[model samples]
Target chain A: MEPVTTIHGRAYPFGQKNVDTDVIIPSHWLKTITREGLGRGAFETLRADPDNLFDSVEFAGSPILVAGDNFGCGSSREHAAWALLDLGIRAVIAPSFSDIFSGNAFKNGILTVVLPQAAIDRLIEVAQSQPIHIDLDSQTVTTPFQDRFAFDIDPFRKTCLLNGLDEVGLTLAQGDAIGAFEDTVRVERPFLAVGVGS
Target chain B: MATTHPRTLYQKIWDAHVVERRDDGTCLIYIDRHLVHEVTSPQAFEALRLAGRTVRRPDLTLAVPDHNLPTTARRDAAGQRIAIADRESAQQLAALERNAPAFGIRYIGDADAEQGIVHVVGPEQGFSLPGATIVCGDSHTACHGGLGALAFGIGTSEVEHVLATQTLLLKQSKSMEVRVEGDLGPGVTAKDLVLHITGVLGAAGGTGYVIEYTGAAIRALSIEGRLTVSNMAIEHGARAGLIAPDDTTVAYVKGRPYAPKGADWDKAVAWWRSLATDPGAVYDKVVVIDAAAIVPSVTWGTSPEDVVPITGVVPAPDSFADASKRDAAAKSLAYMGLTAGQAMASVEIQNVFIGSCTNSRIEDLRAAAAVLKGRHKAPHVKWAIVVPGSGLVKAMAEAEGLDRVFVDAGFEWREPGCSACLGMNPDKVPAGERCASTSNRNFVGRQGPGARTHLVSPAMAAAAAVAGHLTDVRDMI
Candidate 1:
């Protein structure tokens, strides 16, 4: 995972709540095991439209996306996040996101920004043709046209992304603590110490 | 020192289980069961390899190959026909077999008698039970919550989490109580009951909460019916849905292959009984529904909430306050060739599929077969197929002559597989075709790329098969 510090990109304003993963990459694209070919299928239906966001020359390589409430609902397919990343999405601005999808985006180093519905509606307006700026340090999203969209994110996921660390990375960072806990548990509850998580 | 008031069930469960908390407030909670399938495991395994890791607990994790596997027997429904159509992806099943044991996870491959949808296989193998946390790489993981457990789906990285650490750090969820009271009508099924709940409470009604279903109506449903109710909680935006385990639950688990035997079984039963919420357990929210009021249901538009009773009419555009919603409804109605205010039962369907984890059990088959006993499927319809959930279900249906009635009714009695639920296999709707399905979702393109799906009851799907259009099952009854 790359340490994504700053994101400067255009926004694709998709105004729909509860955008499920099934629509992100259909089952047909799931047949292959490789991740390379999926970008072509990212938002495949939206891409199929001649008037789609990707078709607009100005937003073709945009790194930010502005979506409506409840984005990324349904299913546990991380390919939905993978497809967005493959298409160069660095951050997603939505009113809310499905819990599992948010966890997935964080792990894959794709930033998920949650704003109020009003902030989201404003971002949708500013995202068209205007370049959006996202700073992890300030935890704020702003557009070049004087539009500022401040959002909240878990402090933990932010640190992990800033340092490019995931669950494994976090575990290794706690190696000393884990080792100590194992030793203590051996004396406290011998039956569980040998296979703690098992 | 006096402790404060007792915690709610969700809070109590969340508090006792924190493994660790990081700088960002993310807590790593222990996971009990890790379920997987062919569709998502390959990538997670690759991630493990890239990190130079091995599976942490092989016994805790289980895998089944179902999503893209063949429903028919190898020889009769083998690659000959599918090869001509989907030749490139025909070896998807073979790939799963090659990959599973290499990862050292237990794999139940094609035609394994005990194999079915990962969600279905979990309970049958005693992997899903009371007071446990289970994670699967499928949205329907919430289905297992019916057995008084906390279970929900996770993404690929989370899949990797359990594969390596068998734990997930999740934010705690608020609790909600949705109590559906009253008795179900003779023709109503569990599928109808769930669809009706989503209809009244919009799709996102249960957002950010763990919905615990209670009341006489819910308690009366069979373990299978309760499973169906919790299965679609994902459709309602609930993190997980649970029903307290009771005697019915104990009976369902008594003699299964993975269930404990004799003294162990008594111990398991006692533990399961102790897991239920004590009398007067407080809840964060509650909603009551009338079961008798809910008939066989069918969606009329693009979303799950665009539903009406089988005998009711489609809502006119003016019936809604939001213009955009009304416009979307009108567009979906046009695509469905249904007129405003037209009886929803009059809308015709070209396909009727009875499968998916929601309605692919032996009871669902028995219910549908009882309806299709003497009549053939309407000749105008292009397809009507009955795909059983597992081999055992298929064998049972055959033994009871249910398969014959489905076949004799001009419906294709296909093999056991996921079938058209997600349209991963050869079974799917032709582009732009309309289908009446007993599957959980009615989202646009869920059945296929351009296919339209109407979520309905298995009995309603049967009646539609016999009439060639959506109609109330009560009319046949």
Candidate 2:
């Protein structure tokens, strides 16, 4: 897994609030048992619109997305995260995100940046024409229009993103603590102890 | 002195999250938002006392008395609640109101505009957000995870966990990715897509895994559509389902009453962004799906996997391949009165219902209303009701004249709440009657014991209502 710190990727802008997963990957696509071909189904409904963001030649192949408020608001389907990833989107800029979608996105290395709606509007305006810079170390999304917006990230998640760490990695980082706690707890609460053969 | 030990995210989040832990492990979980309804809370609060515990923090928890709230009240002499068909259950509701304030859990008793399904209210209210862990006694607890929180449905024992500890000790599972890519054709919905996935993966395909749904097709859906997809994860036997945070996510939460504002808002968004999965991150398993092949789907039996698109044929019992599978299939079809080679859309219904946490929002109602407008319910269809998921939904729906649309079509415009989803109240299917519904689960007694259910989307339900049979929503479109 590659840790994301700074990115210089092309950007695509979608200006809408509460864009749901059904719009992204729709319910009909849930039949298959694999993840390889879903990119085609991404934004199936939006794709129906000839002028949809994903279909626009200007933003074709762009890996960064800037969106309006309340993005990814519906179900906890992980496919929403995957569709974006497969479409070559490595990062998303929005005013907000669905809680479960964010976790799923992080696990897949999609950086979801929450900026002010004003910053997002600005980015959306610039994304259609120019590239944007996202610096994880500096925590900003800068456009050529002299606009630089700062954002915040939790230290733990920041560390995880910079190191490509997931839940298991976070646990592993505190491996000694877990091990020591288990050992001591076992000795103290003998009845709770069991053979951990592994 | 007690040691100042580090609380795990489970502990830290739970503790700081808790306004207070009540008797035993029951803490408020500092409900940044609480969604409640008529049926479950009465018993839950009753359990609190039977166990001698009081609600620790009312501000953190909110309640809505739905389920039993009468939809026909508007037609009544006073537009007040129609007396419960069962007086004893009415007594239980009385106790809920009397006890809510004593325990400090906010209760939007019947007639309160705030009441609705506990599952739908949190995200709607902006209380559910990324990185938070939410617990609701309802199996749809997983629904709140749509907001990027570590949310899950818990049993009664687990509800008590929140009532006391405001935290849960969950063993992390091997991560799995279920990716959906491609463009779904017109007439397809998230509901059809999830049902299709479960059909192939089998009902238990996701056993013991935390599924991370990724792909272009998934990221493109609306919040309601995503909920429909993940809501069925439990049907696949997955522990939970999740999506990534992005612009669409943030935009949904902004302007909601409780979302952070100013500098704090900036902090929350930044932290949320960093939580996305790492690129090239390894998972225990990964499953990718073709979005283009999906069609409007419907379930044929009790299990969610027993499904095919509206245009597809009924599956033969033998097609199950195993005797048990075949027998189960046979029994479900026998109960449903379906035959192999029978087109799924041709099935008939005695009634049609369009409401539930699964598909009873403004959009859902609107979709159904669009179809129901300028049409009348089929004579063979005895009942067609549109129940909003919450009181707020009812108001919004009524504001849009959806109620009139239903009434004009020979359908009942019922009050907001889970009227027939679980049959915990009087609104339910009569014995031996088959109805097209828009709720989750079709187990033998899911809607009501011996009450046959055929799940469909709201638009499909509306279409079926007009046709007096199960029909493809696309046909109407």
Q: After aligning candidate 1 to the native by TM-score, how far in Å is the CA of B219 from where it should be?
A: 0.8
Q: Give, for candidate 1 chain A, the lowest lDDT window spanning 10 residues.
A: A189-198
The residue-level lDDT of candidate 2 at B108 comes to 63
Give candidate 1's error at residue A185 in angstroms: 12
Cα lDDT tens digits, model 2, B123-151, are: 77666676566666566766765555656
Off by over 4 Å in 2: A1-198, B1-57, B74-82
> On a 0 to 100 scale, what is the lDDT of residue B326 in model 2?
89
When superposed on Cα atoms, how far off is each prediction in RMSD?
6.7, 25.0
**TM-score of predicted chain B versus true chain B for each candidate:** 0.93, 0.88
Kindly report which residue stretches of model 1 are placed more than 4 angstroms away from their true locations once superposed: A1-30, A36-106, A109-164, A172-198, B1-16, B21-25, B76-95
Give me candidate 1's TM-score against the actual structure: 0.79
lDDT of 1 at B476: 89
Clashes of 1: 1
Judged by DockQ cut-offs, is candidate 1 incorrect, acceptable, medium or high?
Answer: incorrect
